[model samples]
Target: MKPIRALSNADEVVRLLGSEGDMSPAEIAERLDIPRPSVYRLLDGLESIGLTESVPGSRARLNLRWLHLADQARESMVEWAGARELLSELVERTSQTAYLTVLRGHEAVCLEWEQGRAVGVLLLKPGRSLPLYAGAAGRTCLAFGVNVEEYLDTVTERRAYTADTLTSDAALRADVEATRRRGYVFSDEDVTDGIAAIGVPIRGSRGQLLGALSVSGIKVEYLAKRDAYLEALLDVAGRLASLNEAAIQ
Candidate 1:
């Protein structure tokens, strides 16, 4: 059998610990499909570097170094410094899950979220992302954040997330036109059944695309209160846009 590359194995161990939390060497080895000895070697190296630490019951988990790294990452997103408070306010007003998303490559990445009482299950959350054509937030980015022609050229395949997902190029083009015309997206069962979302583009003071603000809830409830929700989203987005770049930094 070929030997596993130590660097790649070590990196995979870190990602696994991040997603699955603490695990024993054997557990990590089983999950990675590598030998137990290799797992131990990777864990030992990570512990030596203060990246992972041993826990009770022979488990190893990522240590405080990751917390520092996470804080640094958070600090870099200056535009979102006050997002937690703003999203909390949105959740209070609408009683639905509120999300802050930014376009990264061809995906819409959820940077932050506030869960509400009305909707407990969610497809997008902090650290998760969706394809640019699959959900309200994603479609908003597709419509406003990139060159439509170049983006379309790069899409090799579009996966259907649900029965209502728009996978065809013509459908996506029409959706983009509508999103630009209306200034928001009303996603109905495109990502998850019984779920719907409204997404609006947020721009900087200079009208530069900043990100997306979205709220999601039960389909029927969202449709019934669509106008009110859109008003709330636009209001908050306006405030977010008004934030001074120099002040945020």
Candidate 2:
């Protein structure tokens, strides 16, 4: 039997297994049209690296060790000290939840969050991952006009979490257009029903998009005072972006 590496099918097998969850060698072989023995050999190598683990009475499953590397890479973005302080101030001033997030592997991960005074509002914690197709943070990142078409393609399969979620391609395009025109993104019941959010892009010194800073709250109060909240949200976003740019210098 030929070695898995010599057959040039090792990586594909690993990817298939990682994506499809636990599967026996025969199942992986059937899916990839490779010999079962080759799949087992590839799994052996993957297991040695701690990227794959054997499930009792089942095939190997993907391990989360790669996530540690991914987290390190994500944190390599500009230091969060200044940005987090500013975000905390924004939340204190507005008395609304504020979040700092960056695009991470097709999702927006909250790097920081400041709690609002609103009772019963859903609290977002640091390290929480949100879908790229929903919420103000995601839209703000998407509206930054950096390879947007490619990013949209990558997020096309995201499931809508609410009735107001922009699931259609055309609608998402339109939303992005509106967000670009407004210089920010706003959402009402898009991610969670009865929630509202507004966000703007944060750019680095060279004008590279660093992330998004957003203010979010419950729907009722937001609707009653939408314009005022919009102003505050935009103000904080602009301020944060400027601070980041200056710090990156």
Candidate 3:
């Protein structure tokens, strides 16, 4: 692998170790198909930052300290400039939880979300991240963020999170095209069952893709006020698009 790619492999290793806990260096190397020495180096770096811990028999466990750090980072980003107030306005106006997300290496990572005064699962809450090929927010990012077909080619599994998920590459491509044409995305029970989401791409003042602005709620609730909700989401996205880079990060 190229040195740059190898450097990034550490982050993928971190995510894997975080999700699948208590893995030995050998096991992690096998899972990632990298060298054992590289795994040890990545583990050493993670350990220095307190994101992982050595277990019995030289295994590694994801430390809870990472979650605390994540929480702090989320808090700081939310409180950054206009983010918190905008998300709050979005939630209050739509009565559905609103989320702001950014694309991090083909994955859409949630930066912040605001709970609305409605009943919903909130499965894609803040700090959670997912593949850009799935969900409304992720699809919006896929459509406007990069070349959809090329990006999906790099993803390994296109697993269906629900019956409505677009699993086939052709279907995903079509969906991305439609999202581009519509300038937003509308999804029902695609990522999480019983939840519906509508999203639009948020671009910076210079037209750089900042992230996605999405609002999710129970499907029944969405069906009842789809038009009004779509309008509100579009308005929120427009406002988000006008934000400065300093205020957006």
**Per-prediction CA RMSD (Å):** 4.3, 5.2, 3.4
Question: Which segments of candidate 2 are over 4 A away from where they belong?
Answer: 1-77, 120-124, 204-207
> Top lDDT: which candidate number?
1
Q: Which digits, one per residue and each the tens of the lDDT, describe model 3 over residues 117-219?
A: 8876566777778778788788888888887767767785877888898878888889988988888888888998888988888887667688898888888
Model 1, TM vs. native: 0.77
lDDT leaderboard ranking: 1, 3, 2
Q: Regarding lDDT, does 2 or 3 come out ahead?
A: 3
TM-score of each: 0.77, 0.68, 0.81
Best by TM-score: 3
Q: What value does the lDDT take at residue 153 in candidate 1?
A: 84
Expressed as tens digits, the lDDT of each residue in 1-249 for candidate 2 is 556454468677766865577888888889989888767878888789788889987678878886796668646766565766777778777778888898776777788787887744453556666766689888877777346688777766878789898878788789888988888787888988888887877776566778888888888877787677777766776777677666557
Model 3 spans with C-alpha error above 4 angstroms: 1-9, 22-27, 34-45, 55-59, 64-80, 120-122, 205-207, 245-249
Better of 1 and 2 by TM-score: 1
lDDT of 1 by residue, 1-249 (tens): 234578888999998998789999999999999899989988998999999999999999999998787778867887677888888999999999999999999999998899987967567988778889989899999999988778888895988989999888789899999999999999999999999999999988666778999999999998689999999999988776665254465
Q: Candidate 2: lDDT of 24?
A: 87
lDDT of each: 0.89, 0.76, 0.82
